[model samples]
Target: MGIHIIKMPDLGEGIAEVEVVEWRVKPGDTVKEDQVLADVMTDKATVEIPSPVNGTVIALGGEIGESLAVGAELIRLEVAGSGNQNGKTATPATATATAGTTLPGSPVSTVCERAEELEEAPAPVAKAAPAQAPLLKAAPPRARGLAAPAVRQRALELGIALEFLEGSGPEGRITHADLDAQLLRRVKVAPSGPKPSDPTDAERTIAVTGMRRKIAQKMQEAKRRIPHFTYVEEVDVTELEALRAHLNGQHGNQRGRITLLPLLMRAIVLSLKQFPQANARFNDESGIVTQYDAVHIGVATQTAAGLMVPVVRNAHKHDLWSSALEVARLAEAARAGKAVRDELSGSTITITSLGALGGIVTTPVINHPEVAIIGVNKMVERPMIRDGAIVARKMMNLSSSFDHRVIDGMVAAQFVQTIRAYLETPATLFID
Candidate 1:
């Protein structure tokens, strides 16, 4: 009977605008108070906007992948009594709905109910709906399915047709639980007979939005502004690996198990003492390079969503185990989408590694306005002549990149060599 307008809430940290990544509710969808209406992406993270009062969605503020300024209208809704829009009352005849059009006392809810009914029965081979069909509709017997963005992504990856599966969530919305159930049912019913390969060309066009878009823009800016020069050095890490294994064996239960990353972090922390310029940020606008004595190392981690860099604050303060624990915790938080804004930013330098997948060398891009990034390559056993005799040693390559504007080539090489020296001689890491 009344109109309510919800504007985008300020996501703090002076973010002026945000990209609309997903819409949980569309026009005509009834939303409850505290129900998430949309998910918007800030530079650092994705934030959900919730409804303050129960209402029916009247108009969406923007399309998916569109950017909206702060204080811009996010959604308009039809509510009971007087609303925020000058106490205006929305007429039933003028109410606009799209796609999943639902009129008052319509059979939309019944369609969802029928889908739930089918789910309770034995597994039925349902026909897949056309890809362009609206996911939620009021059609008879075969109304389409509803799911969250994450669930839909996972379903897409697994080649599961959402229309064929029933959702157990509110209003029959599909969830990760439903996905797991579907997988279980699939495994149980799989036939032992040799199945013929049925492969068809299916194209999917995914709009670049959310975290992916942010990553793209950041990477583009960094590449455009910085003149990067990479330096690669091979280090024998046999002693370091041995020391890590011994420490893990001794303190596996008491303290957390030690990984190569903590040892490398310790080496980096120590190396920063000698070359402080590497631990610095550059402001291209002012042409000023600010150096920091305190080292905040950014560890580049790959999550299901995309690449994320979670900073390990004050790396100079933490011991090897403490650093390892912090790195693990931060990486886990980043992967689980629980990392706050502070945890995702303010790094003096960055470290990137692909673990076993790291090949011979890599030219890692600098995390701009930072000057340098250290890349870690895979370790492999190779024949070497150390004291004029053939022997096997675990060798790994340290491929690092630096901004040529501030850091000289010699200084970059010296920084990486310092880290290699500390790693090659594991005892020195504990000395200071």
Candidate 2:
């Protein structure tokens, strides 16, 4: 018998550390290769780490709910027929992972899955209520997912139909919310729950550890150190939206949904080319400005944990459609907590958009050292005087926050105007 020490694998690039969100297997528990050992929290992702070598766990290096740095020893296992049970033997890392595997008990994946299920489910419209009755009744027993005694009792108390809400929790169990919603819909409830707890006075305990700390540190540094100047431009996106609709019609649906952000990315790249000074880093080492030609645009995506920025390398090369797809893919991966270190690191500039939650204008903090950030707001149809006549046009605000130390206000304004022009006129997007 031999025991192998399992140090935490590097979750991804730029991610020097991670928090132990959960430990799936305890000491003395047998784990198979590729079986999940724990869920870890990183700056860019919340990942499920699998076992590199299979064995019975002997000792783990962390306390439950403590944060452990990446590459820290996480587990020690006793494998049959190796060396000493004292865990002096090295682990056998024979398998390599090309794609990320989901970890068990991840709340982020569960939330995403729930959102998709709701979206795919037939919308609960009052008009279609009668027509969908037969389908809802014929729904399979597997959909019910209540086969256990405790779950049955809870389901009955909530007045939940054993069927309707699908079980997503471990072993397909119906949960509290599922039952509550069903009960509420069937019967009315008198206001209970301690006569409405005062929200302003309520305090909840949250463990301030992991990426939350890192984010706080970064934001504090940015606000304290950098002198920021913001410039705004309202661009008419009617032409761009028209071009997008035309492209989607020609190339089919999957290839054509041109998100506003991609168009914004292209505009930023064009402006970056024109104003190369904006794509620069404030080198603390040399105390000088270092400029680069390659534009690495980081798209800020919000996850269940917090906000993470994942980079899209060389945004200049992608057109409207390709850039849209790339941003979408990166944002999805970022939200899923699957983004690696490299994806979250080395961003020259950042662009943040709230999708439909977008409002007209927002001030973005300079992603320190990078010199600039752009915030894209939602597009809305508004009346504008174009060519001496009032007409409705699709318009959105483009906001840029720049480091005033490196970029002058005039230069920042020009750069923002240039991007607005490129977006307002789609032909300039592909032009040299």
Candidate closest to the true structure, highest TM-score: 1
Q: For residues 1-432, could you state the per-residue lDDT of candidate 1 as single tens digits?
A: 778999988988678777788899988899999999998878757788999999998888766766676887789988998878753333332344344565554456568778899889899778988889976766666345787665686688789999988765445667555665677677667568876575563333445567886787688779889999999999999999999999899997899897888889889989999999999999999999999999999999999889999999999999988998999999999899878878999999999999999999999999999999999999999999988999999999999999999999999999999999999999999877
Candidate 1 clashing pairs, residues 3+ apart or interchain = none
Q: Estimate each model's TM-score.
A: 0.74, 0.68
Q: Residue 421 of model 2: what lDDT?
A: 90
What's the lDDT for all of these models?
0.85, 0.74
Q: Write the residue-wise lDDT of candidate 2 on 1-432 in tens digits.
A: 776767778766565556676789886689999999988766545678888777987666665435455566677777877733453322322111102444454544678789999999998867646654664466554545654553476566556667767753334555433443455455454445675467785534444445674576568668777889888889899999998778778874667577667777887888887899998888755779888898999888888768888899888888777788888888888777778767887888888888777888888888877898988888899999989999999998988899888999999898888888998899888778
Going through the candidates in the order shown, the clash numbers are 0, 2
Q: In order, what is each prediction's RMSD in angstroms?
A: 14.8, 22.6
TM-score: model 1 vs. ground truth: 0.74
Clashing pairs in 2: 3-87, 13-341
Task: Show the lowest summed lDDT stretch of 10 residues, model 1.
Answer: 88-97
